[model samples]
Target: MSFNHPTTVLVIGGGAAGIMAAITAAREGAAATILEKNERIGRKILATGNGRCNLTNTDLHLKHYHGQNPKFAYTALTEFNYQNTIDFFANLGIMPKTETGGKVFPFSGQASSVLDVLRFEMEQRKIIVICQADINKIKKTDNNFYATCKDGRKFQANRLILAAGGKASPNLGSNGSGFSLAQSLGHHIIEPFPALVRLQLAESFLKQVQGFKFEGTAEIIVDNKAKARATGEILFTANGISGPPILQLSRKAGEYLQKQLKVWLKLSLINHLSTEQLEQILLKRWHNQPSQSLAFSFTGFIHKRIIPAMLKAAGIEDINKKVSNLSSKEIKQIASILQDWRFQVTGTDSWSAAQVTAGGVAVNEVNPQTLESKKVKGLYLAGEILDIDGDCGGYNLQWAWSSGYIAGKNAAFV
Candidate 1:
């Protein structure tokens, strides 16, 4: 049972990748249609960058991404990389501003503007966008794909591009629908997990200082070996840790969690000094400020809010205790606490808070150059669905543009 219609291309998913694919296919002389399960296209776009989409990064690098095959993204990424993304948005009349660390934000600081530009491009090109259409299954016959919706509607096309995102951010309509479709078609899926998310800490003191934020370095240890580390401003949550540094390290921590392995998160509140160096410095400080209380002496070296805790950790019960009266071992303990304040990460925040998913449709089943499926003809993979994900600061969005562009261009041909 099928309501077959003549179309050159059918693109599923209406996020950044699907919309881009629709625009490119239409521009390349194909009758393109986009099927979005949600009521609106680009639902996730609104949540990006806290309402202002960090569209892309001025700094693009391979090191920002993760996958079983790290090299799998090279071709498509190179084909429609960062500059291409900037040009595409610029052509739409959106002037992006570069913020700290090369993050690019729209000058208007509105994600809706980015969505409008994309929607306008589609409208100008006469691309059909169908909303609230949940594609139940994709059945391929010879040279055509028949996409049957859950509501009993069916769409037929000579070519199909699956730009459906990963399992993360389900409220945005990315709840692993793409995975179900890909699996039905015999595509290998690299087990999906949350990435670019905040980690849930085992310690409860994080709640007492939930809103507190500070610049620190976080190191990840997997089975006692240093796995990864990041340095940035981190925010304490009621049950966990969130922020740039913690988010970046959370990816590896999630992977380790999936493997049933234990991971340790070490936090360095004072990153510039080693324990021994700090100890020596503190000893010298005692000589320099003999009459100063231990807590008072730490005022210049550490944040005032955390000074009491540091002192307590150093076995200093009396806040007004003179630095000169502190024992040698107590001084060393204080120095150690200053250098390394460790935290244990038991898990991560749910997928809703995650910026991107770690795994998706296996890259091995898709052509790295064209983003076309090696297993299914006329089937293409893009965005977070292709086992390609990047770090925060706009790299993931860059992947969306690059993969979407390639899939759209190729799906339009033949």
Candidate 2:
């Protein structure tokens, strides 16, 4: 059968990374074509940062990223650091605003604005963009590669860049199709799991606590040992727990939960106070208001909506009993509960709710400097499809920018 003639480069997947790669290639004088399986390009990108798109973190460190080889990101990150990302966007006409914690959002705080700029850039560069095209086959010949879509359309290129994202947001068009493509091309893939997803618990009381939001610290313990911890806003849901703190712990939670290990969360409703310190602080309050009931005394320490639940958890015999009547041991128990309330994690909310996928193409198979495949020449990988995943905030987005930039620059050179 006759096939399409080879072009300079063929970049598959039109999400964040794919678009960036395509734009980079075209700007370097290479004819680039992007084949997207979705109806529109960058659908997943428009859903990022709660629709505002936290494009990159101004302050990024190696600690923020999680992977089998954490150091694998060192080269790409340095080559296209946060400042480079800021400059890239600033040149694209999208003014980014730094919010609390170095999280950068578009000045309009709309994810669409970021997408629009990328779209405009790709258009100006005159890159060929075809949507609603699903890649069915990829074959490497002696000198180049051939990609055939399910629609029987064939594309040939000297270099291929796979920016098809991970399986996290299938509704946004990343449904593990990229993994299938990579495996077909002889790549070893790490088992993909949901990351940055809300957790589900077996506790029955969560139904009553659903919809309640609290500011607290959550410590993730594996087999009763403290493995990791984070402090942020926690939200109780009908099914389980969510919010920033829970999402921060989800990457580890998802991994350990798969091993059938006991994953527990020690939630501190109060921040930075040790159990002993809390006990002493509460004792002072009790002595200062001897006639006030313990329930009345704790109103200032906790949210009014959760005070009754806190009292119940502490096993206070009388809500109306004066604090002065409470024994020393009883007051300490209340402080302990506030300082170290714990919950068990049963599972995650699933890929639909996951912000980023945990695992993808193993980093060892791809060169970090250029994001090129070690097993195959003229092939590259980037974005969430790689095994690298970052913590909450703008870490994941930063990876997208860095990896995309490297892949694009290298693909054009090839």
Candidate 3:
């Protein structure tokens, strides 16, 4: 337990959380070492926010997160909120800015820069970094933890911080191995699944609206109850729905489906507009182009690519029909469909397509304030390895920062 031993702290997984934990532990006068399984650190971070590196979010409330015990994040989040995250990055020489919906990113607008700051700080703090350390086994003996990598190298330290991320985007190095490592040490894992992922839908609309992108609101209804909603850019993939709003809804949709509950996606293409307003607008468009085909009438109002498909979904299949022939009933149907398009959420995209993992090491087994294991002394958990997952707009990264900060601080001094 000597702080001056120069090898007192060891952090597994050189991800967002591991990097932060190593930096803090080393700076707090403990010898810190980070063992990353990948060839490079922060690979997943480079792909976040479409390469802009959303480092944190302004919204730090518990509701923005999901877990068996979402409230478990309160202590760590309060100890190191978004303000502390901003200040920490500022101290590391990263000027940050927030975009719409409070997603915070470095002023450089490059995820590489975020990694750069973290790497630079780690180097300045003299934190030992070992990349390509694909650890497979961790054991606790006496008062020390020993880690054995698949490559036969061994790591030993007085304290161990498991910041290894969950199984999401395996190419980025989260291959679910961390769960095995934690489970080996008496940690209960709550079946890990994909989060912040796109949902696959029936080909009926997907094939027709593929590649069509728009701004809209998406709601997740579980067992006929609205669970969550988000308003942002929505994109129709060749096989499913995507974009921020859809991604925000996908987590809950997948969770409910896992529990055998009925889940559906309710989308409002004409967000913020009432049914009356939408109907009036549709009527005006038809009146202005009385002789135009149904397709032609909606051309200027909606994307031409989606007009036919939308009309078809609304049960108005004749695209060649003249707008002037539309009765009040047809007009109302179009408006209603526009405002309340429903789709069955078959399932979420694979883990490779997910931005985060929803379930991991259960929360109740860890200390809320320090993130230390209640089952084993000198062991801690942080980041996606814990059960907590957050919204797509940088809330996940914020959780990493908060939990890593708490775990690192306590690991070094405790």
Candidate 4:
């Protein structure tokens, strides 16, 4: 049932941040209410970590995040950091296991478990939750705020926290509507773009390297200057590239594309060996396999599916050419192909494919310590709706948890 009385703390959006905010307020003995648009809460949380839910990471530094003002994260994170998050979940009866790179997941290995904990906490705290209430407009009064739903449900509160997420994973309910809501309330909305998404390359390069999964570095260069670089497993799809490394830099690639600038992908497919060491290895291999065909010589080292494309890119048409006939220059040419492969990034995948959205309300406008708006009083902001986007790890979720806690804690005390 909808909340019939005045809400002391009204938190919008039922995802990670909103729920946490409501919980914090209710636990502090405030009348807290959450208005969620989805059929239920935590739809996006269920999709995190491929259903395992990477809750938080141990390796958190300013380098792992990007925005107009990355320093804003320091205050919120300092107030409630990684260990606090681990303890927060632990108190909820969840035992978390850490994987490589400090990614923490529940021992149960289900996102539903995390969501259930959140549900259980809300029930315990007696926080009023109204689902399927699509917020249409938010208005501010001299004393309080009023959130009007499209279904004619109006909620009044002394304080309002807008945790509506960014324009990513629209199927999961973040359709960028939060931007408009903030803009309507006399707040500036920064231009939003797709982040942590796959990149579509030039058709020719994709056709040659489709389905090639390898470990290496992917660099996004704009106007001949390197913008961002990441190292991880990069997988090529039929049309583009996905995987941690590519998705890490795709946001910058998309931003540069919109500026009508040249963006190129410089890849180092094999990272372990130096260029000289790779050339030396190639020289010895060519000498040792003098009688084998060019195609046969690469059989042991490279996959059969990728050899043709690699050979073709190296300008070697004669796959059957005997190794003895291959010159030192030809071997070096093949080695260079592996070390330095470049492709022009045409664009990034749309919001439907992106994991997060880059750019939102400017960080400087929000008080990082309290997550309250500097311009709009009693209106706190959290989650992906802000001008903050973290890397592929658990940084985003950490921001949601920390910011939600701060906003919730203060929204009640205010």
Candidate 5:
């Protein structure tokens, strides 16, 4: 298949970055085309933020982003900041509402809403989107880039922007094929790993507390030292623990696990109170209900189902013993266990379960300012295909928008 007009910019991957890049390129008066491997464009976008589509974050600090050189995102983020993202979407008739942690979502609260507006914009700009067009090879010859698809269809363009995402959520479209495509074209790729994923633990009692959730702080302990920590609602799984806080710290834990280092998860059930404070509270409760069974004494304090497991893990052999029989030393032990519950982290879930990839094409090989390849002129890179990965929330999507804008603008001019 061939286009009637010459394609000025050919964008690979029809994800958040690719869509934005194609739109941005077309907006700059360049004929743009997007070749999506999936049957439909924006399949991944539809899954973001539990279908609500967190567009961007108001608090887009440098610290939230991670990579070999996180500063590489400085230029793109500054050029297309959160306000720019809001304005860009506003033009497409999207009103955004900011939630806690500065997570910005569409007023419609539907990921489909974001995709619909983007599709409308693409139609208005006459951008060509060819879904199920999986390119098998990309070659630059005679000042033009030629992309040959698996079906033997060939496409030629003046410039190419690779926005194919990382390996995370293969079902949603990204399968790390972009890395090989970039590597074939003289770019170095960083080893990719699962990020923002659930972790597996070595504890057998996890099955008992499976599905139990509580608001607490989860800390990543590596080599007997605290490496990272986050506070949020944590849910116990049959295999391990999960939730926002665990996801936040998974990157560090995954890295440590990759290196075969000792890794542990320290959970604080009652983050609001110190260990001493918790001990006093337990003592007071025990005194008020001295006749209450040790297991039943914590009925109102925490989930009844988890109390027995907690008591057992705390070395309490007889959970049926009366609170009056509980010694002061045992009370302190319970308090310490509640505040410093440790679990050996075995590993993280597979790439399919991860929200984003931790590594990709190395940033040093690409120009951060214009999102262009340093080795191949007129070749640009964008989105999670690069090494940059942001924290949970809307930060990753924001990176997509920013990098796509920069790459699209430069690809159009080239």
Candidate 6:
């Protein structure tokens, strides 16, 4: 039942990073092999950008990336860059198109197209890919690295690239097992947490406004101070709020919640209007329909489902009361609530619901220039397996391509 296959470079985890690493190594004239735990490679890539597969972003600034040592990503990001990503895919027959927020996708607008091209390139290069390869142990001795699977199968290589992803979206293949693999080789882990996920709030009226969607700004307030903010579409779930803006703030909220600090999400439902402007608008509307019930007053303003919950939260208990009876103070309170609807953040959704992982193998333990592990010679780490996780909108995949190329190029020579 045991077999030993030798290659010049062996890559674990056939996700975005692993696939790129193997391909890059093969292009460097080194025989490369990929070990994937799933039935097929790039399973997670299918879920990116809601299946459009954001390849990379036009905006490649350092501000979008997050990690213990985010600067560690500087070298790889600059070396490969977004232009390199577009060109790389262009050469692979993938026509790149730029969308809003500098997000890039294939011209076909299909994630399957992206995977198809990557698979085609791997096939053309004759790269070996072993699916369902649950590597349980990895060790290096002399100049060769050995990886053993749970089924007693073995693989050997001169250089090993641990491109296995972090602990997010286990169904798509990553289960945080890469942390254990890297730790086995004396690497430090930064304690992975769910990122790009929904935040569960402690508010009791969430179900009342569930399914309500709007364009607004979301801010994460930790210990009474605003930590991070994002403005985009926001969604209300049965137990919490979500959508792009909320997901962007989930990382900081989760981190603060891990410390048991008080976390709150302040949502600016009417972000376009100033507080004074909102108050004046409400007054004008009430003046036009002075006899209208408070509940029906906002019929044309916001979602009807949210009106009751929002009014209750703003301290307006008598929704049946007429608008004429409302004092000036009550109108200002409603305006303030519309501008800043605060909800206590209990925690974030589980990893299965997360789009990416917040932390991973510490980047400092690996050389930024080459992505080679300082603890183990010839051991390269890339992708979500490293601590580098980027903001939504193709940044994470860009990191994958950048680090994978660097790791693969360096490992090929090693």
Q: How far is candidate 3 from the true structure (C-alpha RMSD, Å)?
A: 1.8
RMSD to the native, candidate 6? 3.0
Model 3 CA deviation exceeding 4 Å by range? 1-3
Residue 335 error for model 6, in Å?
Answer: 0.9
Which candidate has the top score in TM-score? 6
- When 1 and 3 are scored with lDDT, the better candidate is 3
TM-score preference between candidates 5 and 6, better one: 6
How much lDDT does candidate 6 score? Answer: 0.91
Candidate 2 vs candidate 4, TM-score winner: 4
lDDT of 6 by residue, 31-72 (tens): 899999899999999999999999999999999999877888
Off by over 4 Å in 6: 1-7
Backbone clash count for every predicted candidate, in the order shown: 0, 0, 0, 0, 0, 0
Candidate 4, backbone clash total: 0
Q: Report the C-alpha lDDT of model 4 over 1-414, residue by residue, as the tens digit.
A: 134443499899999889888988887767888899999998988999899899999987878777888888888888889999999999998899999988999999999999999999999988888999999899998979999999898999999999999999999999888889998988898789999999988755566667778888889987788898989888988888888989889878877887888889987877889999988777788888789888888877776667777777777878789988987777877888887777888888889999999999988889988999998899999999999888887989998898899999888865
lDDT of 5 by residue, 1-414 (tens): 134454499999999999999999887878999999999999999999999999999998999999889999999999999999999999999999999999999999999999999999999999999989988899999889999999999999999999999999998888888999999999998888899999999987888889999999999998789999999999999898899999999998988887889899998998999777888888899889899999999988999989988888788999999999988778878898899988899999999999999989999999889999999988999999999999999999999999999999888874
Query: Which segments of candidate 2 are over 4 A away from where they belong?
Result: 1-7, 284-297, 315-325
**Distance (Å) between predicted and true CA of 2, model 2?**
25
Clashes by residue pair, model 5: none
Cα lDDT, all candidates = 0.86, 0.87, 0.89, 0.87, 0.92, 0.91
Error of 4 at 50 (Å): 1.1
Task: Mark the regions of model 4 whose C-alpha exceeds 4 Å error after superposition.
Answer: 1-7, 205-209, 317-320
**Any residue pairs clashing in model 4, and if so which?**
none
Model 3 C-alpha lDDT per residue in residues 1-414, reported as the tens digit of each score? 565564488899999999989888887888899999989988988998899999998888888999889999999999999999999999989998989888899999999988998998888998989999999999999989999999899999989999999999997889999999999999999988898899988757677668899988899887677899989889999889999888888888888988987788888889988888888888887787799998888776888888877888788968779989987888888898898888888888898999999999999999998899999999999999999999888999998889999989889965
Measured by lDDT, the strongest candidate is 5
Candidate 3: global Cα-lDDT? Answer: 0.89
Name model 1 segments beyond 4 Å from true.
1-7, 274-277, 284-301, 308-322
Output the better candidate (3/4) by TM-score: 3
In model 5, which runs have C-alpha deviations exceeding 4 angstroms?
Answer: 1-7
